[model samples]
Target: MNLNQLKYFLAIVKTGSFSNAADDMYISQSSMSKQIKALETELGVDLFKREHSKVYLTEIGAEFAKYAEMTIKQHNDMLLYLDEFATKKSNTIRFGSIPVVSSYGISAQIAQFTTNYKPDVNVVIDMHETNQQEVMKELFDGAIDIALIRTDYLDEVDVFDCIPYKKDIFVLVCNQNHPLSTKEAVSLNDLIKYPLSLLDTSSVIYTIVMKAFERHGIEKKTKCLTTRHKILMEILQTAPNISLLPLSLVDLTLFPHLCTVPLVEELTSDVALIKLKKRRLNKITKDFWIYWQKYFQMQ
Candidate 1:
């Protein structure tokens, strides 16, 4: 019925579980179910069949899926074509960033570049804030000219040239009332006894945290899994559950009730400014990239 419903349908098909699809789409499971139900009602057909723990497509759902995928692809291609057309007509630099851009002072750097370095240049910085997956997707689709993303896709090193700006380390986050808050540092073994609220399984941080626990032979009792940091933090405060999050995302000033503790094992991800290596940049985008390169060297 709607684009979002179509996206949710595909997410359910890809993940094979309602909860997993909700995590992938960064929405509540109930909302996902309701939307899918609405979509089914509109079409007058069931799209999924559930057997115990897994979800499978119905016969008609398989046929609809092919059309749904084609529709989404066409929608994306249309946006990309529009972006390319707009780029030719205007002095705009389509800059994409993940949610935690402020944590790395990326916005401040951009401000300095525009205001201090090239105040006379009539360039518009069109900023897009999204998750890591979409950031990479838009960058590849040529919808966005440059992006600040995590170094999760190591295989794409040769495809894009990037400058590392921040080394984001993992830390334990909990409310002041938590038992672990008093500790300077905690180990993976220490976390086993407590209820844990972690990032979604689809997230890069979640994979790293799980691997750390596995490597240390620790079994984590994950009580909740979500992509929203605010929800994750609120859950920590409402219950005794704790979370492992990036050091930059743990803001003590914003959440005075919360405290962060270092992990005994080191887990880190680099936040970088990246652009396609072979793509020809417009004057504005080219200048912005060159300015950032010089800015990093000066640092």
Candidate 2:
């Protein structure tokens, strides 16, 4: 019925007597007999037949003995499996990032780390990209071990410890034939005149752009708000609507019709590696954080 009871039953079968089994198991004979009695009561069958001075398994007890040994073996195997799973999980670093990691060469930086660092053992790095807000959320919730995110929201969260990596400039993106596309630089005033294609409210750029406009007492017009870069590009290529995007995300070759115009105000945001201050990291994640900290300082 239970592992301990099963173990006791098998011990008696192996030693051929309850008294000898109790001695091998370091339990009193009465306790061992009581356990076997309880197991037999639960199963509604006698497991042992007693002769003058020896014990033998009943027909039903021999069959149950095989299952009892198998159950113990399976329980031990499960324990081993869980232990191995925990070890592998600890060895893997769950890294979260904003969508522009590849655009800004951060992915290359990570690749360099994996190749150059001489860890005692091979460490697995699992990384994924999401919007900035979600990256921050996952880091705080312990869903991710570390994150690459914009510093826009970092200042507001007191619990974060971050290493500043690089500054990315914001630019105006529009189709080549759009009115502002020919301008060398555009201003907030020049931008508000045309309908804007803004990122979803969850994005760091949206938060910063909206704040910048509100601070300047400008009410901007919106053509569409989206979370997908492809959708934003499609809208930009077909319409006069313009979007403010990080310089790293603007690939002129990929979208030949889209051209980037510098912002006259020179708005910029810092990208950084961040982790929750109170969260205790495993050895691999801790080494990753420390390595990047020193790496950024040298840069």
Best candidate according to TM-score? 1
What is the RMSD of candidate 2? 19.3
Q: For model 1, give the 10-residue run with minimal summed lDDT.
A: 81-90
lDDT of 1 at 200: 81
Candidate 1 residue lDDT tens string, 170-227: 9999989888989989988888888888878757777778888888888776789987
**Model 2 stretches astray by more than 4 angstroms:** 1-85
Backbone clash total, candidate 2: 0
lDDT of 2: 0.81
TM-score of each: 0.69, 0.67
What is the per-residue lDDT of model 2 for residues 1-299, given as tens digits with 9 covering 90 to 100? 78879878887897799898886566899999899999989999989999976889999999999999777766654643453458776567789988877777877878887787676667688889988766765664356878988887665467778898788898999999998888888899997678889889878888888888888899876779998666788789989888988887787777899998998887888888888776666766788898888888898
On lDDT, the leading prediction is: 1
Q: What is the lDDT of candidate 1?
A: 0.82
